[model samples]
Target: MTIRIFRPLRVRDFRLLWSGMTISALGDGIYTVALAWQVYDLSNTPTALSVVGVAWFLPQVASVLLAGVIADRVDRRLLMIFADVLRAIAIGVLGVLSVAGELRLWHVWVLVALYGIGNSFFYPAYTALVPQVVSKELLVEAAALRQFVRPLTMRVAGPALGGAIVAGLGAGAAFLIDAASFGASIAALLLMTARPVIRAEGKTMGSVLGDMRDGVRYVLSQRWLSMTLLAVTFAMIFFLGPVFVLMPFVVKNHLQGGAGGLGLVFAAGGVGALVSSLVMAQRGLPRRPLVVVYVAWALAAFALVGYAEADDLWEAVLVSALSVGALVAGQIVWEALLQRCVPSEYLGRVASVDSFVSSGLVPLSLAITGPIAGALGALVTLRWAGVIAGAILLGFLVVLSAATALQPRPDPGRA
Candidate 1:
């Protein structure tokens, strides 16, 4: 079982891509802690804290569709490398200013905007690039391997390492470490000898806008794809942003903890996710992926209800593990299904459109979360958000069940 899960690593291109992604994802975890602390340090308000996320998510909303078009027209390897370079330079400059004590709240927003643009461009290219390097037989394992390494590095090791660095050295050092990690990914991209095959033969358009519209129509035409996107979009709109904006406060004010404590909580979630990913990797995804995705997500949303009520840091840690573990399990299934089902010609555009729709409201959600937290208090708001999100997810399951029940059944006598 272990051998099967690790089989993707034997492919040279996938191994390189995976290795680079692992390093980069770890850096991302480190950056998450560093960025949160840096923003909070500058202005200790929920509203102020939201600016960084708003900056990050706004570009994702604005340019993701265009990024998809660009990914299809260009070399995906070069596109990813460009994104890494842009993000690295942005963070590198921020790290320099931060360490020198000249950094301010506004600088964080501005620089992270550039980082966000780079981020918005990277994913579509990365998603489309994967299948070009790996065989159909190994694609599922490749996805599983990625899920495994992501939690192992990003969630578990990254946050723990970031928290220690921030505690011992400071957030500036953590920022620099994150900036440096991009170099490993860039090097891997540079070393790849093969030019990936692009499948956009008849899919090209006279204009980028035409391309974007085509992508949207394609997604809309597929009921399974569109339905899955709709479910994730609404659920994330209610859950993701509030959690990101509020969790720090819950750790700080409610639990009386610091960056290290928050990191520990994040790491706990990673540990649980690691276990969940391992099980999926070993056994492979369940036969019914759509069912698994919604069920797992519903359980995750409900787990947050317990999170808001945690009495101490340890209790929070345990709940974090469960909620985040369930989230990872669903994500692994959904992503693997996406790669397997989508035509390669549409993969880049579809990936972008998928991200755009799923995340479209996230910025607004982040923008509102602060004001909501300020009015209702972070824990109260989080608790209510969990209930709403959980109920909505279960509603999706109910609808699916009813539809299945209404389907016509076959009989041997009729045949």
Candidate 2:
């Protein structure tokens, strides 16, 4: 029987959740592009943008552990709504200031930091909410659908729209758009009538440390899980900052790209991710987790290399799409693995553990990437980062696959 990617949408609550989140993601996409350019416009230095990234990421890293504990303990729906409300206010204030010609680099940094804290809470709660809304039978399709949201709306359409807005109306308008998008998300959560299955009942704030330790111990006990997480963290450390921080410089300086051009490059990445998600929806995730996840992800290095070498805007677009598509394929598989293998009770915390490790080094990476790219130039730095990232990813896979008891095995039925 063929698996339909939209099967999870048949579930009412999941459908509402997905729809709302999709809109919110579109807003995020707009925010990403607007943020990059707005900061670039303010200081015109890579270090300036990198510092903003640091300010934004540090709060997330600090808040996520506590966010996880809170997510599992509270009504996830309420937690998510509260997070949405907080972010909307922060970004809304930013939008108003930007529109008034009174915005400063410091304002950008502070508001995005606020935005990041809200993001830390929303993520784990949202991850745990998925399994509750859908039956186990539909998890694969649901996972694929979840993967679908970002590439299509956020990466593809959002960037394109943001570029147009930033070019025509200014970054402030884009920020306001993002703030309003949260309303859609809030409405979706409120409209959800289903209780959904939740394992966090009776959990309280008093057990914060105990709950955290349990989550950590569980991840540590699974060699495959822990090792793979480390591999991803190390790989991101090598490449993540370069990808986010240097792209605008590359586009503006080398490719002679305007804001619209930059958005198109981002959209290309989304297109690539969208295509990967479609393939996963049609043919379920691979039986060989090690081969699919690592190998496919490793290929992103080649695309990044191509991006570095691209002499023109279109060439850059092509490579960006290829790299991001490769990334999402690996990510989709990993997310499903976590949902299937981990218990519902630990879902929120484990998801946070994954986020914490993956994101822990991001601020550092962003912090250093600017100075290094300044010294070496954006394209040159990208070439080195790609090679280093690929080596770490593939090296871990080969080493871990050799361990008899440490390899991650996919579910025989769906994954």
How many steric clashes does model 1 contain? 0
Q: Candidate 2's C-alpha lDDT? A: 0.83
Mind sharing the TM-score for model 1?
0.83
Per-residue lDDT over 51-114 for candidate 1, one digit per residue giving the tens place of the 0 to 100 score = 6778877876788888888887777899999999999998998889889999998898889999
Show the colliding residue pairs in model 2.
none
**Considering summed lDDT, which 10 consecutive residues are worst modelled in model 1?**
406-415
Give the poorly placed runs of model 2, Cα more than 4 Å off: 1-3, 33-51, 96-108, 163-174, 194-206, 245-264, 308-316, 370-384, 405-415
**TM-scores of all models?**
0.83, 0.84
Which candidate should be chosen as best, given lDDT against the real structure? 2
lDDT per residue as tens, model 2, 1-415: 6558887888899999999999999999899999998899889999998799888888988999888887777778888999999999999999999999999999998999999999999999888777667765566677788888877776677888999999999999999999999999999999986443355457544578998898888788788788888888888887778888787778888899999899889878878888888787776656775578888788886566777888999999988888888888888777776777667667778889889988898777887998998899888898889899999988988888787534454333222
Find the 10 residues in a row with the least total lDDT in model 2: 406-415
Q: What is the C-alpha lDDT of each candidate?
A: 0.80, 0.83
* Candidate 2 positional error at 337, Å: 0.9
Off by over 4 Å in 1: 1-3, 33-49, 98-106, 163-174, 200-203, 245-264, 308-316, 367-384, 398-415
